[model samples]
Target chain A: MKQSVYDLTQQHRSIRQFKDEPLSKETVQKLVEAGQMASTSSYVQAYSIIGVTDPDIKQALKEVSGQQHVVDNGYLFVYVIDYYRHSLINNETKGNMETSFESAEGLLVGTIDVALAAQNVALTAEDMGLGIVYLGSLRNDVERVGEILGLPEHVFPLFGMAVGVPSDDEQGSPKQRLPFEHVFHENQYNSDKTQQLEQIKQYDKEIQDYYQKRTNGKRSESWSEQIRKMMSKKTRPDILENLNVKGFMKK
Target chain B: MKQSVYDLTQQHRSIRQFKDEPLSKETVQKLVEAGQMASTSSYVQAYSIIGVTDPDIKQALKEVSGQQHVVDNGYLFVYVIDYYRHSLINNETKGNMETSFESAEGLLVGTIDVALAAQNVALTAEDMGLGIVYLGSLRNDVERVGEILGLPEHVFPLFGMAVGVPSDDEQGSPKQRLPFEHVFHENQYNSDKTQQLEQIKQYDKEIQDYYQKRTNGKRSESWSEQIRKMMSKKTRPDILENLNVKGFMKK
Candidate 1:
């Protein structure tokens, strides 16, 4: 019997290295169709998928992402929060829809819509025996991405996905997640700092052990250590300005 | 043979009414595990799931959502963008992680993380023969929701989900999405106004037909009409202020 989606999800690992087999147009269509079917907030469907096939365009995106896989994958899909279509409707009817899409709630709705659709695409591609990695690095420079993709106002490039068959060298297992008890709250949030700190300490140990075992003790960074190293300096301080340039979060 | 995730996604329709049977604790745990396995941005699992079982809490949340399913479902899950754990780590280590999580990029990362995980849970539940509907209505009163759920700083309720076995009367088909060509651009975004407006005109007709057929000719609102009606006025004007209050997007 085929494994259930839950089982499939448990096996998920971001695949960076991939075989050079490109997906067919039919497969791309199927993936997009699956993505389109994800639940949209109020049927707004405030997102679009850009299939980057032009090698030059992919190269441009790769430069923005600073990732080889952005250009090496079988397919590259950049998901954008798109309200340009709604804008068209607004213009034709002379309506005031900008009051909505220009608000912070609009940003949340668009972001949620794009992510949900992308996850569907991710899971579906995985089920089809493809490996995928998200390219948030696309946001490393939003203006350049917008220029590369020719995205219009009210359409913000949130992230990209590189999908293809995994290479033999790509053999990473799922990373350990936060314990269910720590992430799952019953009825109300347990803001008890002591309990939360205890859970994190245990998780930190597990992460350290996993890293040590994976790298023969060459690397043994705990989760907290890694997070501190990553988050100590702001990554992409220009995001707010970029969002404004893209005509998002302007309310 | 079991259905593929793509096939499963194609059949997705937001299910509101549900059977009386609640999910088992083991099942909930399995779903949460599946959610946790979704790829997070840089291993920043910046989200928490609140499983509301207490009738009073459910009723309180239902008041915020104004949705009966919030109280009537087999289970209710409120997905929050959580940076509280990271803040704790920052406090203990006296790290400058706030420079990252306080930025707009942090908001994007947290929102994307929560939505991706939520989608995993949605698909997993559907695969298990249960139904689910997202409750973006939870944002209708974020402050009230925070009070009800006892959410703390660095944690914001983004949305909720109501899950259960589908009731016999609960039968609805997936709504037609925008045209594949319209939503999926090749190489880059084609922001040509004429092309986009033409696509939207066609989609409007399809949506009109869909509603007319579904409601036995009682309703025939076009997609454009519905969007104009829903978005002409601002929704959740306080989202930005709320984000600031919750210690998000402060920079």
Candidate 2:
């Protein structure tokens, strides 16, 4: 049976373009309320979301994010991995609460908490027939984003999500995934699991063919070639020292 | 108008006690399939999930997590923040993908990507009438968990989600939340938004009352007080430096 959950799963795709329209206040409220309804950790609810609506601010964010369509197209949400609220609460209660970055574990909890909440909001928006894109580029200059959001110490912007009704030609196919066998392991992780190599090669061919078809066979390169080009040109942010400065240890 | 998303949101809660019944193979398949359907970064899909079924192993994890219900519960899933697939793909293509501590962006992407997927599984599980509790405590001993799962470098254990049908007594009330004003911000963040301090204080009182009513005031304390006690203890894992060893740089 084609289950409803699987149906929802099949419906997900990253949307980069949107119709020129603004999101309603009611829609924003519903999205955030549904997000708050997400499963939070220890009821600490250690995450904060900022909704950006001012076109001037959106234009600035678009520049910061390399002119991504989502930044300027519709509703942009900056999800912050926040422990600042707990710190505030701690201050109120005296020397009770603390934000210690002794290990990667602390950072992991905050990141995951924000991720879960954001996904819930994304799904709820999609259920409302809106398209969405997650702005990983927000990290390109997270400090800028933090400043824009007026974030305090212990609250780092994990990333942003942009949501809106899709323009007609904005549909994109599901990006091919490594087979479930490659990603999922049974009892112990099997690194030697290359039984799908040949299948993946076929997938590489399929990807190249799809790109060619998209460009009328003008650009024909395998997935490996594309990855090589992308990897060779390092575009990652200088966030290592930034996290340390913001209070997370590499430990 | 009441939104269906509201109903779905209200359905989320942490379920600790579960019947000894095992989840069918079909159930696990459906859950993981839903997870795989989550939106990923650049379609890199940088995450993997491992399902634990062996009772002995489950018991061991339960001990590690310091939660009795871990072994006695339904399906326990360890959502892993993984960049190993990209590394392998890099190897195959001889793509010069950097695997340095400076890959803070990759780690964040992996952690956030997997977390988004895990949250989907939680929601899908709930839709199937199941309950879930995210166990952040699993990070208390990263080395042990890594050993148990045979995790490779670049694949860090993010969090655990214990999923199953809830036993009647296990139903906990919605944990009191900070007011909407405290958590949500408009175009820009208001850092000194202590205007909501009164609301937070009210929540603290509500949580203390909840604990007292449930425990006959045996462990009466405000939310802030409980958080203080939790932060007072230095019981986190010793795997912070290990991230650097695993190729993550704190800067």
Which candidate leads in TM-score? 1
lDDT of 1 at A113: 99
Q: In model 1, which runs have C-alpha deviations exceeding 4 angstroms? A: none
Predicted structure with the largest lDDT when compared to the true one? 1
lDDT of 1 at B206: 91
TM accuracy, model 2: 0.91
**Candidate maximizing DockQ:** 1
Tell me the TM-score of model 1. Answer: 0.99
Error of 1 at A72 (Å): 0.7
**Docking quality band of candidate 1, CAPRI definitions:** high
What is candidate 1's DockQ?
A: 0.92
